[model samples]
Target: MKFKTLNKNSGKDKLHSNDVIADFLHEHLEEFGDPKEDILKALNYVFDRGGFILLGLENKEIVGAVVINDTGMSGYIPEHILVYIAVHHNQRGKGAGKKLMEGALKLCTGDVALHVEDNNPAKFLYEKVGFTNPYLEMRWKRKQ
Candidate 1:
């Protein structure tokens, strides 16, 4: 599979748009994904703040995708947060996800991190890709 990286300056038309990438992730991430709007917001963050979007394509169709957002710092926090990663259901087990993960990791200059639920099967893949659970995350959400 060929890999494509998109940034704010990438062409706005067709497959280059954040809308397209968001749609692709929304569909491919299945039960593990957030809503398309949330995915779009994250995609926007990469372009507006700092980060990147990577696409794995085979025969011009997206087999997998990744989004990484730069934390804009180092040392205390990971330099990047792997915001999202998903492989097309039909493409799973074919090394597409692994390739996407490795490709994203290779592009980053500093440490990268991601969050996964304990029961999410993808956690194994993340672990296989060298992500370690060094700390337990706690979040306090405000009532809407």
Candidate 2:
């Protein structure tokens, strides 16, 4: 249940690779079908642009992860977007997800935002972790 910032050269970062991330996504996508390449692309973009935070063992096995970005749109006040959050199926009921989120929130300088589909069961967990429903957005991607 230890938490650490994934250093570039650290063994922890090795667990954050595309293959592992994709595998976790694939396991979840069985009900959602294969996700588009763009999804992985977006994940890579977030990893690069948002600075990823991972939750796992001190030895390098990742149990959960969260990606966040600074939304440039400015007006009222605090701002940031929680681009993605995922807890490995094996680690779901445990506090890995919440610990990862708390780590993300601690690093955030302002209010954060994220989208969750109405049908996602994780929505309940999100709410339990203090996220609120703000609005709805849709995605339209043509089949490859």
Candidate 3:
């Protein structure tokens, strides 16, 4: 597998690749509503926020994906946050996820912050890569 970075432009332009990454994340995390448009909006938000995507590809297929978003003003010290990561269920045992994270680390200036479920296997990969601190991942729940 090859890991590559998709800048904001390519991430937004490549619809098929975007869907593969977005759908994987949606199925694994279940963070968004069951609507196609919602996924598009989320990807657009990532692009608008100056985030970049790291993708693990095999035979031109997206096998693993990671999204990194930087917070704070541009051109200075910013906190890079790992927004979402997903490896195709069939591709879990491979090192695609690790390669994606490593790629993100190479792109960031300092330590990156990300949160994963206690039971998620990817947590082990994060710890293996030295992200061994506790962090809270919080989000606003829109009242229905």
Candidate 4:
């Protein structure tokens, strides 16, 4: 397996646009994208801002992908956030996801952060990669 990075100007020889990344996220993550268009827009914005979209591949087939933002507001320490990640269904339980997460963590130059669902088995993998559970996430969405 190998890891590659994509930027705003990166070619599509390996993968297409943010839409492709969003599709991968939707496949393995619940509540990933109710209206995927929103996810695509968000992804493009990240790319334009010099963020990262990393892909994990094995012999030219994508096994996993991760979205990371390395910069935030000005005057800050530029801590990175691992916002989204997923491994292909057929590729799970074989350490592809763990390798992807580990590679992303190592690629970051600053502190990295990510959120795992309470019941997500990937929590173990994240821990294995040296991530600690430091905070609880709370969310409130306006009723539709």
lDDT, candidate 3, 24-90, per-residue tens? 6677554422355565555666678766777777887777777787675444433777777777778
lDDT score, residue 2, model 2?
Answer: 73
- How large an RMSD does model 4 have? 3.0
At residue 28, what lDDT does model 4 achieve?
A: 66
The C-alpha stretches of model 1 lying farther than 4 A from their native spots are: 9-13
Which candidate model has the greater lDDT, 3 or 4? 4
Model 3: how far residue 72 lies from native, Å? 2.1
lDDT per residue for candidate 1 within 1-144, as digits (tens), equals 999887667734375577778888999888888999999988988878888889898887888889999999999999999999999889899888889999999999899988998888889889999989889899999999
The numbered model that scores best in TM-score is 1
Task: Report the poorest 10 consecutive residues by lDDT, candidate 1.
Answer: 7-16
When sorted by TM-score, best at the front, the candidate numbers are 1, 4, 3, 2
In terms of TM-score, which candidate is stronger, 1 or 2? 1
Overall local distance difference test of candidate 3: 0.70
Q: What TM-score does each of the candidates earn?
A: 0.93, 0.69, 0.74, 0.79
Q: Candidate 2: worst 10 consecutive residues by lDDT?
A: 6-15
Give stretches of model 2 more than 4 Å off. Answer: 6-15, 28-36, 76-78, 134-144
Can you write out model 4's per-residue Cα lDDT over 1-144, one digit (the tens) per residue? Answer: 888877666744444556667777776665543366755665675567756778887787677888887566434433777777888888888889888887787777778777677677777887888888767768999999
Model 1 TM-score, all chains together: 0.93
Between candidates 2 and 3, the TM-score winner: 3
lDDT of 2 at 10: 40
Q: Which stretches in model 3 have alpha-carbon errors above 4 Å?
A: 9-11, 15-17, 28-42, 73-78, 134-144
Looking at candidate 1, what is the lDDT of residue 120? 83
